[model samples]
Target: MRSFLYVPGNQPKMLASALTRGADALIADLEDAVPPGEKETARHTVATWLRSLPAGAPVWVRVNSGPDGLADARA
Candidate 1:
């Protein structure tokens, strides 16, 4: 079985170190873990982190619901 770890999207340090941990996959979360005021910032941070990946990294994103979710999807 594979393991997946959850990391808050707003956390840059966690995002940078997550892939080194040994989990088979990662779930970068932008929902309940992030305060509303930081939502936009988290989106950008997550997006930038995703781009910085070396490719084929097993990372999944947990976006929020409603309009915010749509924005997350777009990011």
Candidate 2:
């Protein structure tokens, strides 16, 4: 990918605007960029955001490791 943009998962506005930024890849970050208390929220938000996109949306999610990461993967 030519451009890899990191968008904080907890920020809905950013997530919505990210897809149009012309980045080759969009990264929904739910780890260090998000507060501990917001991890779950970010997960749900990111999942929904990804789902709303069309089949060709270049999006990827970066989640914390362990249970949270596994859960994020499933999302």
Candidate 3:
């Protein structure tokens, strides 16, 4: 079985610490986990976090839907 940890896309500190939580995979959430006002910030934060990770890091992203979601996917 695989374990996954969910980290909010808007919270940088939580996102940072999630890597060490012993989960088989990490899910950086950019949708429901983030408030509407912070959506853009969350996208940037999640993108930066993804870039900072080492290659082959077991991570996945949860993006929003529609045009805004398209922006999230692009990020």
Query: Which is the leading candidate under lDDT?
Result: 1
**Candidate order (lDDT):** 1, 3, 2
- In candidate 2, how many Å is residue 49 off? 0.7
Number of colliding residue pairs in each model? 0, 0, 0
1-75 per-residue lDDT for model 2 (tens digits): 688999999999999999788899998998889998988888899888888999977877788899978877777
Write model 3 residue lDDT over 4-36, tens digit each, in one string. 998999999999998899999999999899999
- The TM-score that candidate 2 achieves is 0.90
Q: List TM-score per model, in order.
A: 0.95, 0.90, 0.95
lDDT (10s digit) by residue, model 1, range 1-75: 389999999999999999999999999999999999999999999999999998899999999999999999999
Find the 10 residues in a row with the least total lDDT in model 3: 1-10
Error of 3 at 48 (Å): 0.6
* lDDT for each candidate structure: 0.96, 0.88, 0.93
Residue 37 displacement (Å), model 3: 0.5
Candidate 1 stretches greater than 4 Å from native: none
Clashing pairs in 1: none
Local lDDT at 30 for model 1: 100
